[model samples]
Target: MNMTLTENTLVKDIVNELPKSSDVFKRNRIDFCCGGNIPLTEAAALADISLESLINELNEVVEKSDSGEIDWKFWMEKDSEAIIDHVISQYHNPLREELANLSPYVTKVSRVHGGHRPELLKVYELFYEFKKEMLDHAEKEEAIVFPLIKMLDANTVENREEALNAIKELEKEHDHAGSLLKELRIITSDFIPPAEACGTYRLVYKRLEMLEGETFNHVHLENNILFPRFN
Candidate 1:
């Protein structure tokens, strides 16, 4: 709201300051996760967007966002247990439900449209595979990795090595999920529905796009915020 952000600020720091800014970065195709450490001006240049324009859009989004309802910076002050619980309840649980619910639409669309739109077949295959992998990934985080993280938070000396190892493995899984998301984006032409696309087809693409955004934020929280504190 105050336009406090500048081009020199790191992309991740911008997102950290205003979590809703992620939608702006995603829309602009700016990398605010693995490459998030880079300054906003550099990120804008890499994405082929004008720095002044991007900053203006981000500020506008920040101004409109209800920061009082959701404070991204609050996570920085939370203890590890509280953060883990928030991640589980907010990201992990919703991801599980959405992945489960969206699979049916994906299947139905591919069945109806795969003849003309052959890419739907690939989309169907990739999504199911991604879903399966993600379900397993979420399971590991909930059953194994998360508990270890909490243990580390409690200063359990024996859990440190195991927690670090588990986190490394989880990061690898995140990379695999990211790769699938990229493939999905490419196959769907950035999730644009074709001209003749039916309502269901459009819905499938829309949900897929939503899935991509949610997963990016979910992974960002873990890879950037959660893991670093323990590691």
Candidate 2:
């Protein structure tokens, strides 16, 4: 059952799984490109697409090639040190670098053209907020939660209760961060840049979209694969 997943498995999750699946996760007319968090039941009702059909499609893709790739799924089944190292080395730092360049561009573009397209100002604010949230979020994961996950994975029950407590706190933080992200998405209208926007404006919006996609994948790895396996 989907209980193999965490509580936050929204419709957007299906989108993330599709790319890795090789076929079943298509983006055409599917709304996967936009709001990936809607429940599958909700999405099916909205689009008149059948849940059974979606399941069968996924099954076909899975059977065709349990493709021997070291995908996120592979890492999800790992210890805390493994997941933490992968996130910091592979995901977080590169995102920070991208945001560093993008933040100034947002301010610059808004300064030059805010009078014409006020939406840029809002976009600028949301991007900065997201960056700040992400910075703190990464630190929390590395400092506290990850160590516990690693400890538990290694079957070190000496500090098991303490690690469990840390995980509970981290889960609350995750909920807050997710709420903020959802608000940002609403503010940006699914990150569709205005038609009259310049390249940087468009690029920034595109980057946000990409980050959302990546973050969903990241969260899925933790929530569905790593956390459950460790638990």
Candidate 3:
């Protein structure tokens, strides 16, 4: 009833209750997995949302949410299927499409301006590797991991051992991919575009920055939320 309760509450506590699904969590930029441990006000500021509004929205969701997000930590203990599905649909598909459109632009710009900016070439090179790796990685999650995680939610322990073994391999790959993403960030210099950057260059930087942030959230969800549950 009291939207105020969600207003100043620590992000970590909220995340432990609301998860990535909570509208309040979404508005305030309270990353439900890795950076979930920040103060509510701080997270709101970082996300450019109103703290009070975020609280109000969350309260509305909670009041209406059939499965009231009373305990985020408890919800996380349930299963990883939902989070995986969200990633595949919301993040993966959109990202793949955006990457396809952006890659050619990056290549063209890099060829022309690379002699002067140089970072364009760096970004172009790293993006190629990142995009290629993610293309396969997303398929693996959809084809294999997603289904297996769903099985964990539905089936009993009869075949859990086999599932766990497969999940372990996926986890290792997740770590490796995480490392590569970190490297890509370094290569892009945090995706900073020069003031004099052309329109296309500016757009690339913006999208790359968004990609980095979204990817960070995605991996954190898998590593902290999904992987632990299944593995």
Per-residue accuracy of model 1 over 98-142 as CA lDDT, tens digit each: 777677778988998899999999999999999999999989999
RMSD in Å for candidate 1, one decimal?
13.4
Q: Point out the higher-scoring one by TM-score: 1 or 3.
A: 1
| Per-residue lDDT of 26 in model 1 | 67
The sequence of per-residue lDDT tens digits that candidate 3 reaches over residues 133-185 is 88888888899777877888777546888888877877777677667667766
Q: Report how far off residue 97 is in candidate 2 (Å).
A: 1.5
Write the residue-wise lDDT of candidate 2 on 1-231 in tens digits.
122322234645543443332123332234543445576566556667776676566555445322443476467456667677877875677667666655665687778777887776776777787789788877888887787787787787577778777766756666665676677577678877678755445555666665676666666666666666544
Return model 2's CA RMSD, one decimal. Answer: 13.5
Which should have the higher lDDT, number 2 or number 3? 3
List candidate 3 segments past 4 Å from native: 1-79, 156-159
Overall local distance difference test of candidate 1: 0.82
Which sequence of candidate numbers ranks them by lDDT, best first? 1, 3, 2
* C-alpha positional error of residue 174 in candidate 3 after TM-score superposition, expressed in Å: 2.7
Error of 2 at 120 (Å): 2.6
Q: How many backbone clashes does candidate 2 have?
A: 6
Query: What lDDT score is found at residue 96 in candidate 2?
Result: 74
Q: In terms of lDDT, which candidate is strongest?
A: 1
lDDT of each: 0.82, 0.62, 0.68
